[model samples]
Target chain A: MTAAGFPIVRAPAASATDVRIDPALVRRWLVTFLREEMIVRRGMRTAVVGVSGGVDSALVAFLCAEALGPANVYGVRMPYRTSAEESFRHAGLVQEITKIHDVVVDITAAVDGYLRYEPDASPTRRGNVMARQRMIVLFDLSAKYGGLPVGTGNKSERLLGYFTWHADDSPPINPLGDLFKTQVWQLARHVGVPREIVEKPATADLIRGQTDEEDLGITYERADRILSLMLRGYGQAAIAACGFRRRDVRLVWDRVNATHWKRHLPTTAVVSPTAINEFYLRPVDY
Target chain B: MRGAKSRPQPSSLLGLVPRRTSLDATGPSVELAVVQCAPRKGDVAANLRRIEEAFAALRHDRSPFPDVVIFPEASLSGYFVEGATVEVARRAETVVDELARSARRACGRKVGPFDVVVGFYEEQDGQYYNSALYASLGRRPVLRHVHRKLFLPTYGIFDEERFVSRGTSIEAFDVPYGRAAILICEDACHSLAVTIAALRGAQVLYVPSASPGRGMEDVEPANVRLWRDVLRVAAAEHGIFVVYAGLVGFEGGKGMSGASRVIGPFGDLRAEAPFEGATILRVRIDLGDVRVARAALPALGDLEANLGQLSSMLARTSGQSVPAVGARAARRR
Candidate 1:
């Protein structure tokens, strides 16, 4: 029961796994948020999105086109030399469907330029360099094209810290930040995203044969269920008791706790009486 | 010859017809539902789509469906929208007609020759009203009642007066189940509106509101407690059921109070929805409960008898000449 004495009925476990969302409600919410937070509040007329041919970025592009017309939306596809041909093809599909202005930036030179500094850089370092390089291109185009860069990170990836920090997570505004990966897939289907892109294996497309589940060691379906339980205030023991493997539960819990710092602004040592983000606080709009 | 007189013994005896002991107990009961929804600010089309979805969900239930479904204040266009021009205000009749058609089509023969009451900003004759429409849905649709907001609250975060016109009168009208009346958000705060409704023979009083919840930690939001007290007292005092359907959402930094509920005529809490989410609360009520409560305490009868005297006193207090009893009665009729 809630504090107000109303019974708290949890969504059925099966339903939670399949997460029913009212697409119209979500569409209206995103449209209103963009109108208020971007155009009306921040005085921005155009939006720039980095479309990677995955469900998350595809969903973001569709939402931006819906909120601001296709003429005002700019889709940037940044591909490295080793990037999959399917990635470029799906990105083109998004551009065709949304009819938004599109640009292709080849980042192989920039990435290889940095890789020359350390020939033995690990795969993780190389992936990070690619992610950061793509962001650099997106941000630069945003400035040159006079648009604000919008993010495409979903909640599951964010909670699991699957993306490179300060690279994919640095966009000024994001419409997909709160939707889970599974929910994003549902919304993608509802908003007319191509079936091929929605059904493809989730990946960052940095390596030749990398899948998100293989890298994270947990399928998105299981990860989303566990994350939903944790969000509803279930403790580690309680979640395991609900028929989940204890190891997986602990893994998700540890990841969420470890990545807490990535969700907040940098900590500043307080020197004066009222320091930034301490006593001298201001609202986001302010 | 002497008497002639028993003045033709009175044709009929006074008070011979037995006073109705429990009219509500004899009549059919009604299943009522209140939908506490989070409306998208200034998005009428989306909000209407959501309301239709709720009705569709109710249609699938095998149990007895609600005879009347109530949505929160401004459920069509949202509340606190002072920035919306008159162009955004919807015509109440057109919206209600469309909703009735949809409801009939969705429910089919499974349910609802029922009525739906929803709030919206009503536009008519170059003026706008914060209004609630009582629409009846069957094979065809009928506009039963339209209650504009009587009290336009303008304190603190409320700027209703700046956006819409105030309603002119308070009266109860007949519905399929029984007599009922409607009061918009701030109107529920005024006791006189409830009294007038009950005095005018309302068995059910519907208070649809968009009151924002405000309070500190560990304490109930003030509007929740206030509306509860109002509904309870009005129900118990006048023996009329009270339904409060409050909107739930954060609009421009203001969070609405979402504790929509139904109070029985005896002041019993029937059902209450949550304070933060979108929910449909259902409760079955016998209009006979009103008769049961009224029988226990004959307040309505007493008030009806004393109204003429009160009117006279009011006239005197306001320094106006009192009309002849016949003329006053004629005017009332």
Candidate 2:
């Protein structure tokens, strides 16, 4: 039986006659593909979403639990030594409330141990190392349990140079890439993310007592409003009207503009006679 | 006074009040034929006439009439602009006017509530855009809602960026039967626009393309295996209907393999047209497909998480660290 409550209709084969296409029908087809291909055939599809205990990860964990069942969704809480105790607590509470698989991996030991080889590392360099370590931990869990890793970064984070390279960026899927931080909160509430996770101070919790706004020099509410306006094709003045500092808004814009390469597949030349650009395929095996 | 119970409730200029035709708990089990036409090179008038004739033949004939007709990429102007000027690239108004007239006429003839979607080369302020027009009785012919091929295929056989500007907006509007979204040929390959439309609550996706290729007999053959894999995966994941209306027949010596097809909400091939010439395909879509898919997998509910993972991958690629293979391996254990 199909997931849509209809018996699965397997066509014998594609005939030259099977070529008439309707756009409306295609949408239904893709949804069905996701259900059968990813959920059923894949089997025991557990997923891990790295939660900073902020709205984005919190919301993602909640939704993954809903999609894969609480038992199949795993929540990984990776906190650095500088991370606030509350961030860890909130992640734990979110896991308990949502009933998702939860594990706490403290990376301070591994990071600090690695940094001993190089004592003169700058804060930014150290931060990047810490972020990558956290990703290493999450993927380790994914391998152990057999699932895909989910990400929590939003358009705001992607646009603001707010994430670490090769760290939180790499995931099999990202549910909130198009959404702004504000929109993430809306979805968080809709998905019943814990109130603590929703209302907590937005922080990467990278440095001791650090917060995202303090590091970026702008609050998410302000940054998200600016980003929303910009994405809708508005100009600088229109974005500034949203109460964000003009410099901060421009910074976010430049970050998104500069890092656009990270958002796409590797740029390959369409050199082959029949080589279509941007349709390159890579095989994956588990 | 003669009994007026049978008289059509005095027609109104403002809008025709829909009569209470028996509303079925399940929507009409009616099949819809979606046809894509590749207008002769720069011949808008011929294209309009061809569309009119197809509409007439389908509507008047005892054979089944399609609920909607779709046209290929720039089918209005044949997707070719000779002189790069506004006068040369200007969209012929005849296509829009004729399409609206056709829809109104079809409704009047009770041709089963028809709608027409056409693509054209639109020129405005010295800039040319690859645009589409959706004409129906319930709504006016809307031409500005264009899906300019976002990822312009500047290489191989495609040079879209050189001729057209990219479209920024993603729109899905309400149709009588369902909310519909449009993505032109190259747009379909990218997940961004499709995901945007899905997020915006569109239930039907229309892909109008002038896809070029040969091998009408072997194109997307079931025996090939990979195309079927693609079909099964794309349809089932999105939980929405997808209709591909591709241009067929020979144009400028290049064979257009019209492998137009409709995939059901559950990712099943509902109907398919031939790979050559103009062909018509019809299939009935039940809205229940989406509901059922959601209920069975319960996966769509976690759409945010799924998208978040992709976004994270995007973030990971930003920095210099090799995408932690260690991370991928960890998720498996």
Candidate 3:
């Protein structure tokens, strides 16, 4: 579908050889456009996505650019003092590639400023404070621009117990909520993200030296492979059969199984015969 | 060789013919009548009269007055009444005085006897809700329950989130003939609603919908079919009976698909109504059948256990339960 009827702006694939859109990818892209129209037609103005210098954000930025236009899309890159120079460089690379306007706000001052007032916060708590500071900034910007803050967290983050709720993660809109990390990479390449940025190690960059895979103690390639099997209703034996160690399989299972609540809305016990959310979400409109 | 034994077996035909085995007490079978109709837009008076007329005809003809009559979502006001304030108020009728008068008049003027489950817009505690009123003749009509929609879908010609607040509750309650449950249109798609109803021991699930039927320009017929099938799966999984009622005819330029149907505990369609005009379907449902099916399959038992796990997981993630040192550090907001 062309731009006349569709709102998708597919970037030139990584190379001329890979120009064709896979049938599955095309189907998903159409669904994405439909979803965006659903959001925009409801009167939302713009979208703000956290640019984490990772494949997830890159794909999200591209999709946002396609759905809402480059002018209607904004990116916020919050890098701490220890943040990799590549974080700033790649974010700029994506902005130049996509031509979406962005704000490079440094949150070190804000994070340190707040921490000085509250001394007893733990390392995890402090890390969360940094994550939430970025969100607060994004939301403030969202309100200013009358936009929705789009989430960049992929399915891997959601499945592997990687996200911090209401802090490092959680957004008003999640475009890539259903895609895995591997799929994120595939989309990033298809959307023409620079190889330098796409190949870089994934990280929350909460602390200067931290990387996500290091913190989770597993590589994304292995993690995604394990998760794919798990999602298919496979057990530990199948995971082990796929070359994942028993402990690694157990860890992935626990992460997904234990953090199940992150995937759903709050639960309400049945009290009346006609309970909303108990049987279904009743549409208030006719 | 079998002549001697065959002669003795011939003495009792019960020993030869395959018998219909019934597990529980078989009571005197009573005809249960149900009216499924496609209501017009803001034509509350007309819809009420139509229902009255249908019931009156049923009684006079001795066709059997429906024991229970269910209408579609916001059937009185029709679904898409545009203005926020006027539309909300127009649809929201409490029905204490209005429905009582209608019931008495309906019995005398139209139907000789009947009970009703009518969908309407209602305002309570200064909050507007998509509500339903259950009325019975010769008795104070029970309000039954009102459910505000939970997921306000803003996708594809839908802007419900703009006008309605999300409901925070999921429940089921008892009605006269059996333990009955009700769910609105979109509620029929979500598993949580059906699971909760089954957990509460509801024997029959009633869904009244104003689903956009075929040729709405924007809406598809497939979505309607999907919702209908999902109802069956939910009913079978929960070991409960489901009665689906939908509104037909065009309202606010959008068509309402009126493929209303009823499914047994095993996901078999017991009855169905056409997509046009008002209809009254009477089918006898034995609660004992539900008991027999549930006893044989015992699926609801696992649903209960799964629900417990779901709750604990929710409590754990929300940090609603106070945690120790490690847990406190992870507590967000």
Choose the strongest candidate by lDDT: 1
Q: State the displacement of the C-alpha of residue A119, model 1, in Å, after optimal TM-score superposition.
A: 2.6
Worst 10-residue lDDT window for candidate 1 chain B reads: B1-10
Best by TM-score: 1
Candidates' interface RMSDs, in order?
12.2, 17.3, 12.0
Put down candidate 2 lDDT per residue, A28-146, tens digits, no spaces: 22223223334643554778778777788887777677666789888988888788888888888889888998888888899999999988998888888998998898888889888
Interface root-mean-square deviation, candidate 2:
17.3
Local lDDT at A108 for model 3: 87
RMSD of each: 17.3, 23.7, 19.5
Best of the two (1, 2) by lDDT: 1
Report the lDDT of model 3 for residue A177.
68
How many clashing residue pairs appear in each of the predictions shown?
2, 88, 18
List the candidate numbers ranked by TM-score, top first. Answer: 1, 3, 2
Chain B TM-score in each of the candidates = 0.87, 0.75, 0.78
Candidate 3 residue lDDT tens string, A1-286:
7758887768864421111224234324423442433352335758887787877888888878876678988888888776778888888778878888878888889988999988998877788888888899999998888888888888889987687777545675666665667767777776777888788788776667788889878887788878877876777896687677888788778888888886775677888876775544333333
For candidate 2, what is the TM-score? 0.46
The sequence of per-residue lDDT tens digits that candidate 2 reaches over residues B1-333 is 011111223221222212322133254343556665555555566666777766765676555666667777766655534343243354435556667676665445565445666777777666777767665533555543445556667775566776678877777777767677888876766666666666666677887777665222232423223333443445566666777777754443344556667765566665566544566655556665666554544444566456556556766778543442332232211
Candidate 3 or 2, higher TM-score: 3
